[model samples]
Target: MLQGNTKILLLSLLVFLLIHPSAYSQENSGTIEGTVQNSSGESLPGVHISIPDLELGTVTNANGQFRLTIASPGTYLLRISMVGFEEKTDSISVASGQTITLDIELSPLVFQSDELVVTASRRSQLIGKVSVSMNTISPEELTSRNITSLDQALEYVPGVQVHGNSVNIRGSSGFSYGVGSRVLLLVDGVPLMGPDDGGMDFDGLPLIQTRQIEILKSPGSALYGGGALGGVVNIITKDFSDEPENTVRLYGGGYEPVRFETWRAGWGGGSDFRPRGGIIFGRSHQVTDSFGYWFSGKIHNNSGYLQNSTRKGFETYAKFGWDISEVMNLSMYTGLRRNNNEQFLYWDGLDDVLSPGSINLTGNEASGANDGLSDRLTILPVFQHSINPNIQYTLKGRLFGVAFRPLKDNGHISPPKRHNKGLRYGLEAESTIQATDEMIISGGLSFDENVINSDVFVGEDSLTVRNQPEGALFLQSEYTWNDQLTTTAGVRYDAYQVHTRSTATQFSPKFSASYSINESLTARASFGRGFRVPSVAERFVNNNDFFPLESNITLKPETSTGYEAGVTYISPILDAFSLKAELTSFWNEYRRLVEPTFVNELAAFQFVNVTRARIRGAEASFSVSTLDQNHQIKLGYTYLNTTDRELNQPLLYRSKHLLNGSANSVITDWMEAGIDFRAASPPERVDTDFSLFVPDAEVFPTQYITDIRFKFQVPHVYEGLDVNASFLINNLFDYYYVERPAIFAPPRNFQIVIEALF
Candidate 1:
């Protein structure tokens, strides 16, 4: 059995390296560089530096300084975590080649504490730090949760769930075969979906150029490999460290059927190419509408809002950095996007009552015109080797490429233009090993190449090619059975080779446990096993008659098994007001779940896997912050529950009782204001009934909605110029609902924004 499970995982990693030890030592180590400001001094990249009883850690770069290496001199104990700050400890005295310089000041853990604890495993001890089912969205809870995408900002992240815009972790079903390719989207750390449909179109993601939005639900396929089963939504972005800044944003809203507008502008700059590198660039744009149903049939309104149609897009991102000195560093990134579209399709009886609000006379001509373009290139070369300080090593590499243009139909039959191209190429080799002191190990390997030339699934001059070679091997062990229990187990083995099928192997098992119940609070539990394999439009496109791949060849490769229990709380006692909450509940059971079938029937759609379902959900989140010196206030809430175990029903367009709230105030010293609110639960429809020429085929309907926003900011003038403004209101009462009843969800709109910083 693989040598007794690799000798019981090397005798449980030699009993956790003979009881944890290795915080730093090479004669007292010698490196402790500084820089980490925020009491209004800027600079704060990555942030996590620790030495909690010698767990040894480092992460600051991007100008916030940080050069860890301890255990050489004498008296030592340092810790500084970040995630809305507040957790700093210092007491150092070392010598040998001495070089300790400090300048730390962090505060704002939501005005002292209601608990928003999130240092994502780099430690702050929130019950064994991190083992899975994660959620850490803080940029002041993402600008008071005005969220535009990251799947609507993770809809209040808990176990996380969002359907219409896609995002379903813990309760997998990620929208099924086509529109949702089972989770996996990262921004910093690359991979942003669309590599031949691992799915991700968060309305063309650009959430105001992000700054933080980590959500790891679970199953990262061992440090991200293959769509990551159904979790991982990284996103980070937003680094230009002082010296220059500019921003402009506009918004428009509607909800009485639908209507919209949007715009964005950006600018960036960098300096001191040494504090660990820096450089950035950005761009943005948007447009929208939904008067589908011809203004609701001359205003008698059917709410289909004239069948709604129209959408536009644009985006650009760039980054460059290099600092080969402090233990080696390098970075490069690029992204570009484009979109133009018009869509609408509806049918029924006579359709038009003389253009009673017309989608151009009800019925037949259902429109379609699309132009989507994407280009991404990335190069990441990282090397960190502090081999002398309690053993340290990190070598990373990544090369990426992507090009996709999915334009379906246009050319009425013969002479049509035809275009459908998709491509992907990737390479990765990662390593992180800390050997002793209770062990620290990380591993990786990846290679991918995928290509597709759709004709809407191959047909008009068809062209198809698929070559995939996938691999994964992972091992993790973190054990500290004393001071309050901590246990982590790992296992991973995934393999794939498909040119049509053949090589397939999966072995996933991960377990976690964290317990403290003291220093504020902590308790956690986790179990994992996730797998997926079925893409390329779900195994070779063959519609309009051209079936032979064994007609979807008895496909099978979609598994899930997840369980999570959570609890973590930190407090400094009311009055300073601080609270962080997390309540997770998940039960996933799926085996081969891909739907949409109808082969030879002219209006084709097929991607077997038949049926098998089970998705249970529970999510909860809360936040509260209040700081008096600068007058700050924050509030938040989120709750969700999903169920659909083969018709046990309740999982269509998601949205099941979601409420979000927010408020921010800084009053003077340049002014600041904010407010936000949200509500949802109405969207669940996807019935096909039996189509041959369209028999019952249903679409979507079920409605409830609300939205509101207001913001303003202005700080400093000459020296570090700053200015901002925003006002938005969408659906906020113009609500007639129906975002997918054959499409139509926009009504009651308004928006405005302006910004600048230097």
Candidate 2:
């Protein structure tokens, strides 16, 4: 009873369906049968297995097994892909009418990859030969840990710590109240900090698309310029997935009741549950043979563990790729984030730690100054062209903007509203050329401008403006002396001019060498000069009298001379186990160190260049993995010796000893588990007079924290769909701790995560 057009449509649909699946049954066809599993030894279900050249694919079944047939196959490419794990591809030779078997193991993203690192040198180089102490966090690890912000994950990195939103590497920073971060943070090679805060924003980054985080523990100003005095953290975004598909992730969690009734918030039960959850919806596909796009949107809500600490956020991220021609390509990445947060400055006296502390409110202000709305947008476009095999260059353009407006949640009285509207834009071009077989040259030129209009600035009455323009030229040369020895030398010159001020300039230089002593060992050493320009905030911030913070525009830049030596060894200790270990020692001498100082005359705090300081440290870390890479154990230790030359005392807020460890195992085909531990000795000193302003302000104690997590996976939950459920317990011992004076660290908490990939 169907019409002629309907019959035609049905026939076309039937033909299209038969073409992919039935063609493999014909003569001379080849068959591919395979098993897919994670490096942790759990078989993966719902994995997409495909031969892109032939436009044929199959999904793995309940047992992580798959089979596919190809007609008229000679040689083809085989690819397997899944979410939360790395994709794998292989080349296969097909003999007519023959069945080929494959066993594919995909590694999880949490394990660091040392094959290539760009942060250390501003160019791709092998981690082993980079001549720096470099660490990496794989994307899978972030996903597995269910971290909602960037700072939360930094806590697990060796020799690195977070003081509020500021990051300290190798004891290079202290509690300066979110100004002038020594460690530079970048997202896909673009600076991530704003002009007003000069501090990292934890919640605005797009994590779902991050591929890897590279931590270069050395003076990076020679290559990255200012803000790299301590080191660099680069978050590399990912390329589109190999297969076109959609993914969904859902996670939720909350804290357990406080162990002590005295510390309970006036909420549900003894303590508020502080519920939190988030959802991510993502899709990626190829629009044509030469163009593709990937994007995701995330919405997260959190009740927070303390009063006036709630936060809600929404973010969207997208990436597009275009293979314009055989000799050129383009990549475009964009991100937008909107966030509302109730900031908790410090806890009330230890007796009522779950309550927000007052900020010396004046007038009839009712202590509700902790609310704010923030928005951020970033766009980066990169173009590359290949002149020849030895000559290729890239051009990058970027725009980063931030807007923040303070809000009052309850009754309040203030002189003026506070707002920050900032923008940063830049253009850079770089090239890599092989001068000869043993020599390579890399160099770049950059021009950037920063502008901020805000009422929170020291000299600003209402919405005043400040801006700085900068230009830089950098060059690096790498020479391979022989099969076992290599050296790199680089230098950068920078010029900066405030719109209304005179120009200032600096030159940074660096030299490093790496020697492969043997197949299993490598030795490296580096020396560099680093510098940091004072941020607009450090030079002009005015916290509106709630806090005792003032600004001094005369603050000088901070500079350092750093030296490092390290050795890496890969031991063939056992036939069934692989061991990799590293030991490093470093020394840094800083001059004109910028720190916050209490001005007795003004009765406020100010950023001042007050001291010459030194930080010397030793770090050791090792990892052991089974032959099958199924189970892993990692351990690390760091020792720091620091002194303020002007005061003859240890640097404030610098932990002398730190230790961290982790163990992971696959218990069964459908189950896996991991445990992580971190410990630190209490800082030698904090604010000498903090107790006068806030009770127990110097209560930081030697601390220990542990986390445990387990995952259960269901493969083939439906056709081409896989599901994984995870549970996590943080602060397993329920220990009370603080990273900074008077700031309450998170208590014991639990989380559940569900992820589906199709």
Candidate 3:
């Protein structure tokens, strides 16, 4: 049933037959100019000057200049990245009216090898040609910690562990409350979930108009097929700054008021310490010579330190670009978010931690819990054509929708519920083929469709409309077998259907390798296969919140296989320091894993496909920097060893030691300072049958969290303005932890951010 104007006339005839009527004629073009600096010679503004074989690039302003204007004219290779420098490449030559000038320097890199990713091959490359274990997140780590949730900027990355949007990478996810999601979320590479709890709405993204966020831990269903069975993040946005611009940001904060008055009198009181704020607005322009646009919007409110945990929201993002010739290029993206929240779910025990109850499933205890509002929207359209420049062709389309409304106590307007909607639409067609500069190839073909109108997925066929459909086919390749080897391989084929059931298929395969033997050593390896299916609220939920869920329309589909190996080393030591080190080892294996049991003759709870697991791990990271590169320090560690090969032991909420640390310094020329640390090591097992529905399922010890920040860069605050200010502290020294098991994880907080740029 394809209506809606026949799916907008089949996506406008597939972007007008993938636009290409031959167009490429920039007369005799040629030009290049630069001024990047940084080996003690300062300058360096936003660096990144490129020419990855004519893909062109730019960035370097605010006095560090840069310009490129080449439409054609031979010989290239002109890199030069930034993010702590050291990545230069040069080898130029142009003819036909030239205009070259240069002066690039760089040097002060400590293992940041010129990132240019695309979520590990949905295109772009270089991040040392990725072979597993990737992470990137940087947009000043969410505006210097004034972070408005992207899971609090992934709770400080290293081997991730976030508790509310449930992520666990490397330990490979544990909580399965939001239905089915083994990490897979992308925007700017399409794929978005939660069309009825396939989870990952992480506040429905737009994280400060993000510009980079890659993640990609491992096992990505080959070229991304099912819910990526644990891996993939990819949210890359932010663009359109070729001149005209405007931006403004404002922030505020609170929380830091519980000095143990018996935990503020056990929070029997509602709403204490209410504060938190936000504001943002932006714009970018350019309207001719091939269009351009960019936009951002934000509005947040929090009032949450407990009691029904308040929250408010509004998010927005927009992007547009066009240049239909020179071999096409078109992009469009838009997102919107709306939220109202106020419904703390897991408390009321642990000595009434900010009160809100739930511990049902006959273990008894329940209390008012309902306050919500959500509305989300997204649209994406992309096009690229270039059947030149070593082959390229992409055509994507998407339209996502969401709705939720629950509110029935206080501030009333309506109640007794029924307004949950979700819809997903899609299309994809990708291809990249540099098919022979030592093999490049990539492939894609996708389709998706989902619809839901939930009652938490009423099942027993009391269904209130639900549909799911999916399709995929992927291919990948990357070969470089030289200059110290490189390799990659892939495959994917998926199929789905969930309403008139009976059609589920899977196949994903992968292999990877990277070797570099010298040049500061490198070695990597990977193997993968992944799958997941089951999520219409885990196969038709029949909700009761706190527990009493039941629906398992033949549930079954979860598979995984992953393995990794790594080694890295970078050096520079005594010439005034810069070093990097990495070591990794991972192993994963899961099969039919889906929990939420207790089906005593259907007396309740059910989303079965019970356990079979394995999760061996080892991770490490280290870094140091200095050499005109301000200062830096990093540390990472992870060690897990889960096993539940049919209840053998360990693997319930899995987390066996994880740590992360950081330090930054650049205390002058407009200030900077930082510190962060995180630790975890709890939940070795919490399944007393899922704690009979979690009422102080208590298993919280060994977790220390701290964070700190400060920054200022208020220079010439007006003309073409730029201003910045920051100060942050998060749970710093207020670690009364609980990352899982009764929910209490936030106590110390502070913030202040002000930014302006024009």
Candidate 4:
């Protein structure tokens, strides 16, 4: 054994000598020092501090002090982890013989359960610092929603509007062909958009794959760049952690309105000095009604339920991390998804209303469902490093491609191949600087390029065009004015060059001021300006002749000004129960709006810049939690109301009010259960053509839905191995209501999920 070891060592030395000048040609390195503290100024010891994906790590001493040594003069990622405190990461720059000091403030982990996030600026900064309203859906929350697509998970969030796979924020609606474009979706800071039109297929994103979903409810243009005119949706995936034994999850359920089954599996392992990688594969079988409010065009409780439409999908994602050294790290992630869907249409009514005798519709005849298929592939490569502590930087790039094909027979027995294909590429770089104990600065630049192709030509001459670019620059600064006050401000400049003719530029500014009234109460106010450009669908529909955004050089970008003020009060005196509540009111004015118009003479619709609208609303969330460590009970609620000044009515497809509540408790030493309920007011549809005098439809109201879940440890199983099962019943009481003009909600049905982990 000794002889063999000596031979191996000799070979390793020979290889090293072949690659370098000498083994002892030494190089100098530097170290970093830091301390951790909570809001109360108490030192937090045992905190894990290290450069992510690096071979170096250390723990905080009893006084919350840490030291790290590295051999590089570049940026590195510094991550601080603790059991009861939130995880914080920053980029740091290291110089030879230089010692950097960084003192960190971390919120308690309790907030993680509440789904709070701070990635809007490529760094760790809470939404409270921004003027916009934001909401976060934690992993726990995602599990509660129990749906596979982002479209279903965001339905309960306030100010977030969803119709099927389409999403819009605030009162910005009706931008793309019956869809909305006021929102941008991202995953791990990578833009999740198709290359051609800057929009995404919501269903193509898997909800179960994400560790967190941050929903910013205000125009994020000032930070997220263009297309953020409505808002931003950031999906953060799971981080690199200690290798797990294994994990498997399965779910199956079906009803007259909807049916679905899903399965997922993952594995991970590697040496201590080198980081590991993992891959996950998920497949699901889904089916819905022929026509309904969501999933399909057929109503749930009517004749369409018996003739359910079908949808099946597949998703696969992978992640790999490498530990180059203590000061540098690299990671790669990718995901692929495909969906096949069918939407059944009823032709009997249409045939009678139009060409009465054109076709025979009497005896249970069917025209078949429209066949639609969508596919997406996303690839991201990320590199980060922390030189020392005070400064760090990151480089991330993403390439996304999507294809959508719509096929229909129209009873003509022959249908041409019609589809849309798009591809998008994006890159970003961010730098964080801690100049002083009281100030921190962050800056970043983002660029996106899209290429789109549609079967039908657009414009006056019916021509096809491809390739467009959008870019932005953003910077944010946070300053602490003693212990009583803190202030944050940011600005972003976005530029969009149309395929032809003209370009639009916007400069958005945001500011927020907060005053700490003791340790348990705080007051804050924020203001900002926002703007958005038209979507590709609105600019050039498949079968319509519409001018590109550039041709209409005179068209103004949609703009808004907003203001909000709120106060948070927390108390822990009531029977060890904590009570926290916040109330905020906002008013915004929008201008140079775009709306779809009917070109009756041409037999198709066209997008035109026409009217302006003003919207105002208030929102509040209050929660009372009984702090029992192992068992807890909580109640929460939210309310909102928005109006469109031009139409003298409420905004379309938006709920006027919302309320949510839940309770959680430990059933045993290794078992737990939770129940949740939700309620929302009605929504309204906007009229697209005033000349026709067509009145908008009022969506029917809905009652609350209650859901339950349970988790238990399996006896005689591996440590930490447990099973989780949940039963969700939508329309808990069988409430009959319409979410759209003519579509009805699904009747009461139950869904079940089972998960096992070690």
Top-lDDT structure, candidate number:
2
Residue 119 miss distance in model 2 (angstroms) = 1.5
Better of 2 and 3 by TM-score: 2
Question: What is the overall TM-score of model 2 with all chains considered together?
Answer: 0.83
Model 1, span 1-758: residue lDDT tens? 99999999989877665333322246545777787877755665446777877677765543455666665466678888764467888888767778778888777554333222222232122312564566667655554444544566675554455654457665465344243366777666555566455577564444546666677776665555556676777666554442234444433333232222110011011110101111122332211121100000000011122322334445455555455555554545554545443334322212220011212211332222223434444444445554333334444454445554544446132222234456665655545444432344545555666666555454222545455566677665655544455676767787876445377778887777777666556778888777777766566555332222112534567776777787766564455765556666666666666665555553344567655666665666666555453443333333445555666766544555555555566666445555545555554435442222332224443444455555666666566666666666655676544333233344555545444544
Cα RMSD of all models vs. native, in order, equals: 23.2, 13.6, 23.6, 14.1
lDDT of 2 by residue, 554-594 (tens): 77778989999999987545577778899999999998987
Give the distance in Å from residue 505's predicted Cα in candidate 2 to where it truly belongs.
1.4
Off by over 4 Å in 2: 1-114, 265-270, 359-369, 410-417, 460-463
Each model's lDDT comes to: 0.52, 0.79, 0.77, 0.58
Best model per TM-score: 2
Pairs clashing within candidate 3: 201-204
- Worst 10-residue lDDT window for candidate 1 reads 291-300
Estimate the TM-score for candidate 4.
Answer: 0.74
Q: Give the per-residue lDDT digits (tens) of candidate 4, residues 345-402.
A: 2211211111011111223222323556677887888888765445567898988888
Which is better, 1 or 4, measured by lDDT?
A: 4
Greater-lDDT candidate between 1 and 2: 2
User: How much is 127 displaced in model 4, in angstroms?
Assistant: 6.6
